[model samples]
Target chain A: MPKTLTKKRMIINIIISLVVLLIVINICTVTGTRSISLSNVLKGPGLEPGDNIDYEIFSVRISRVLLGVFVGAALACSGAVLQAILKNPLADPYILGISSGAGLGAVIAMLLPGISLSFLGGLPIAAFAFTGAIITVSLVWSIGYFTGRSQVTSLLLAGVVINAFFSAVIMLMTLIVKTEQLRSTMYWLMGNIPEKQESFLLLSCGTFVILGIIILWRISNNLNIITLGEYESKGLGIDTEKTKIVAFSFAAFITAIAVSLSGLIGFVGLIVPHAIRLIFGPDHRQLIPLSAIYGGIFLVISDTIARTAFGQEQLPVGVITAVIGGPFFLILLARYTRKVSLMK
Target chain B: MNIIEVENLGFDYGQKTILQKVCININKGTFLGIIGPNGAGKTTLLNLLCGLLKPKTGSIQIDSKSIESYHVKELARKIAVVRQEFVPVFDFSVTEIVSMARTPYLGSFAFPTESDRQIIVESLELTDTAQFADRLLGSLSGGERQRVFIARALAQNTPILLLDEPTSFLDMKHQVGIYDLLKNAQFRQYKTIIAVTHDINLAAQYCDEILLLFPDQNYKFGSPKEVLVQEQISKVFGVEVMKGEISEKIFFIPKGNYIKNNK
Candidate 1:
């Protein structure tokens, strides 16, 4: 291939990525309840005077959509970084047991009646979830580091043990909690985006975006070498241990933030990067940014469908994502399995 | 002057000793081949010299500076190593992989400069992989892949290049091709190339110096004429060479080899 052609193809890929993102965002923004036209959606949802439609569009719907976008992008980017560092396509944002740990923490926070004083209003579920994620990831990282093997297998095994322990705690809490608390806990676990203040969503999303960018940019080179295996990467002058530490820490931080905001949205992280790899190849210089954009687009579309598919009752975003992403994941797994078998 | 020096180096994994008190020196623009049978610490010694592992005792120096004192990027700027058994999970293009050799010279967020691209292209051309610059590395044959790796080291354009069993999986034709390329690169470009190989014939044919390691705590480090003799071969490998040549070209025929008899 000529150098000019390579440059041209890269430019084309970038343009295609931008176009796809715009199309998906537009499709998501226009396809809500009250059936806003494309022109009206573009002109601004505030064109009408006496409808209270603008409040619903800008406040409730757009905020929720943006929240889903931010969380999804964060989760997917984290997954890409983890997969690259760990050199495992099966890695995901929740691989470190973060979701289960956060769930347990949220359940514990809910069960303590006097803890309402600390939260000031009902319960700060996000804070509890964040703390749980941090603690679990820190523990897993420490275990992996102390084992002296810095291999993906050790980290994954530690994650599995921690995940099981946290899950047991969540199950125990579920059995003992009151019915009302149980109902709320179950709802949270099902993963719904509540009608949050725009300011809160912006703050959380902004922090995640900033941190995600820093991580993606910081370890791009390490991520490249890491895919070549640890020993090989070390020969190439990469500090494999240091790179792994930074990559996993960044991944854990982003996963924690995403789980805090969205209450354990499932499979977006696992599916988005895999899909992008199939389409755009696995170079993280391209993969990371593409995954972020595609993840955001995917979640926005999925959330919009969840919200407006029914007239009065909104579907849980998790359910909608599972419905779409489950089949997609199965298809990918089947394809990969077939390829492997053929190779054999 | 010696570009690399190792003194009384030893390493062990828990209870299993891999290398014992090893000493060697590599001078500038010299091609040194470390040869031994399997489990003779050939790769281990290369790994130690490349700073991939810390010796249990003693030290390594590059250009009279202790290897421990050099930052990874600083050492990388002076030396490049290509190891065997590298598997890339991603499908990076050949050009992209080769350009990674310039990483030590790059800033945190900087992309490759024009000169870096030219270096990558020239390296690819030198390795005869310029035609495959846009191909994904995962799609290449083993020989092609090995050449691509060589191209990456060449793109680094450092004074020294280290390779671990670079020709292990290559066909004879590609092996010869790689040797020819390395020979020219060493003499023409003045690269100090250190390679670990089990092929004594290839080492004898191309290397300026051979470091022969034996499993029974012994080693011979010298020119091919000194190290590739019948007695040394019998001692290190426990095999007799019935006939050998050391005049204009060095060649050896193992005992009871019918092919050599026909030749």
Candidate 2:
């Protein structure tokens, strides 16, 4: 049996998670090819460009770490909400076809360079990817909602089918694109942590993600009731359908932002929520906030590994996540399934 | 006085009529048992009364207010339902699950207050689930889990409680234990209980009133003795039933072919 989480224990856990996140941020910032010290980072970027190489590298690393933190939090929170509302443990943000749709949108943008000019100086690919994610989720939501008795099951099935179709389209587009474009597309598909992003874009996305998480936090209890299945949720006065709409919209919106920032990062969403649930318990009020914090920590660590492990060549952060997270998730899955079977 | 009044309630799925013109008036604190064979729409009736499903025709009134007029939270405060099965994705402890019942009473940012915590504790004690309060819900036995779910319903602190096949999966001992718990809740807490079950004898033993439903939206509503007649049970259920009394309470035993042939 899982130990019940007391208020004091939960508070301590939260504090520890925050501390770990800070330590990880510092460690990740000081890592990489240049190997800048914490003191150098503390001095901050100098006024003159290129003159203070240490500070410049430090600042760049900090930005990347910040991006990793935001991206991870968004994905994990989205995953937690999706799993609760969908009533499926295996559910992740990308399971809603967000990734495939984003991939397809990005592939189209690459194949046709004319669309890129609509944005001034910023990566229009991110914009296209965000649009694609929103469109795909909306399509899945309506199709699943209007079609039937078991809504979540229908929603999942629709997502899977739509995801397949989009992936196929992306594949076809890749076949015809020029070699240079293909290489970029392949890089994007594998997913890399960009060294720099427009500060405005980063700020906006971070703000939105934080806002979404806060909204989800406010309704955390509702998410808990909704997980008990439809009949029970309604009995608890949840307005289950309304809760689903609100949760689904927020989760998808934030996930779109994360996917737009970093191309199709996997496993953070799928694993972090489960790990948090196992360690701290499954009450959503705690689950949502803890998962977000720990998610940031987990991704920062994984991204750091991605940067340092390959020695300047740099493995895509997504690959590092799957390679590390896949096995860890499987172990949790095994323990989870065994416990369930024992209960029977 | 009637706490729940149903008039000409009709429900159907697409073209198939599941319930038609069902009507009943249940007074406060009444232990009403709903019994039927498969596909008799007993569960559907329970859903409709609780506002989970809307009636296709006619109306339902709770405390003389139209059912549809009550907000979901408002309705929840008036009625609590214990489902047949609860399988949660994340395994929450018994106390945690029961505390969720306080959601309707909580403000947007408020945690469970002192009063709410008192209610949760009281519910666990009442349901004899206090021992399992800290145990994860999945780790408990089926009977234990069912009791925890009942504890949750009790924590809702509603005037009325509805259950759908509350003991269909339990063994005889567990089945008796559950019915006993419901009867106690009805007696001690003065809660109005409406349970849908397939256990006819148990219904006769525990319920003050019985509703017997047949296919095609037909039903009989009356005292248990009036509704659970041997002839009616045999006719509707398509089986042979012999009625008897034990300790002055009515009971029924189905007379299968083996019994008839041997006798």
Candidate 3:
């Protein structure tokens, strides 16, 4: 409990999580469908991506790894921020119905033909999904403000109502339209990494993830104060209302970008923050960055297992994340509560 | 000089008026206590003074500047507040909470400097929470947690300290302990203090001046001896009380009026 001890421990954890992330990324590249040796994947810029067999496969795997890093980091950090602002440990990007709202948009693009062929080409789904997420979140926020003093409880309830409504819209579409035409949409809803290189998407999502991390980190101390409760934080000189608005908007921004990149990926947001919080303390300074790193490592591992575990048929990465993360989270929570009790 | 000046200040929540036409001036280095019955708007008035709420009418000036003109951090640097209700959600260490008092002085992203650390330690020590510095907030009892919160306010090192029923739910020992700590902070540090307390006797024993309020817009502000009388107590609270004096300090004892009503 000494001051130096806590700081030193935090340093060690950061270093350890970074090292583990690198190892997970390397292992993911080598274990994918087309096996590429670590040497080629690790090689410098001498070899071009489209030049040869190992190079092409390595390039695809590398891009997938990059996608996982951006999407995972964004979702996890957003979850941490949301949890603090909403004062709910269970809150995440999904709480605002972003995932399901985006699902409806993606489903429309899939079931309704000719729309995808517009100037957006295949990217119509991403554009529509982003729009859907923003619309749904803003609606929830407006509802919360309309009902009362912009209470977090009202916002949470609004999110639940919107999420259910979006789910029904998706279901109605499913029942009326045909499933054969919506194969990719179903897979996307189930969560899968981008099949192609998607370098442009990767770059945009990377910008969001990096910039979001920096912004959230600077206000990390504010997040800590906020967890103390709104009035208490304000008493300490924080403009609690302004901070809440900015933090929630930024969280929603990153989460929207994450959903647009990879369809409805779940557990990275829920379980990664919880996992990091368990290992490290609840200080957002630690929670934000550590969750980002651990989240990337976790998704990389999950995606690797999805592609390799079934041999030829690739499972949706979302299923893999939930299947693995859900049980792991339960076990971590059990051990965590026991440890906390023991500390007293 | 007056540390805080309110001229015909009034406030309302939605359409309901809480305080109206209230005027008061709190001088520097004074121990001011606000006592009232249930729903007397003491907390609301305290909230307004701390810039948590904007008055619907009139002006409140702090140190010759209007409260609305100062930024939150600027206001915090001048006045630190101890909240009455403390909820333990996170397991943050006592040191962490106490050090947060320096937040108003530091930049948005800055960590504590060496002097900030010294002040935090001193604050914790003065509040008798230094021993529990490493303990998580959730691990402490209500009294211990209250002390930790007070330490946080002390760490702000502001010229004025505002407390909202800080000792309301505590046992007698902890209540006196907190009051004594605050008194020392006021007398030794030469800080202005304003506490909203429902306990009448505690107000009589500690405060230099007491502001009495009713659910209506009426208020009485003066020394404890002038403000707290049998007539005001009976009229405001609808309860009978007996007043006693011992060791040159006044006390209030309830006459069990509910028993009389039942009879």
Could you give candidate 1's per-residue lDDT for residues B1-263 as a string of tens digits? 89999888888878878777778888899999999878888888888888878888889999999998988878888888887634477767788788778778887533577888788888999999998787777777888989999999998888999999999998899999999999989988899999999888899899999998888647889998888887778667767675456665577656754545455
Candidate with maximal DockQ: 3
True contacts kept of each: 0.44, 0.61, 0.59
Clashes of each: 0, 0, 0
lDDT of 3 by residue, B1-263 (tens): 99999999999888788899999999999999998888879999999989988999999999999999999889989999998756646667788778788889998754677888899889888988888787778888889988988888888999999999998889999999999998999999999999999888988999999999988889999998898887788788888787889897888887884655543
Score each candidate by Cα lDDT: 0.78, 0.87, 0.84
Clashes of 2: 0
A1-344 per-residue lDDT for model 3 (tens digits): 23522445666877988898888887787776666666664554455645566666877778888788878888898999999998888888799878888888777776666653123534777888888889888999889878977588899999999999999999888777665656666777888887564578678778877898879877888998999888788888898888888888888988888887788988899889988888677878788889888888888888888888988898889999999999999999899888977876
User: DockQ of candidates 1 onward, in order?
Assistant: 0.37, 0.54, 0.55
Task: Single out the weakest 10-residue window by summed lDDT for candidate 1 chain B.
Answer: B254-263
lDDT by residue (tens digit), candidate 2, A169-273: 999998998887787788778876677887787888889999999999888888888898888888888888788889999999999998887888989998999
- Model 2 docking category: medium
CAPRI docking class of candidate 3: medium
Model 1 regions more than 4 Å off: A1-30, A35-53, A114-123, A326-344, B16-21, B246-248, B252-263
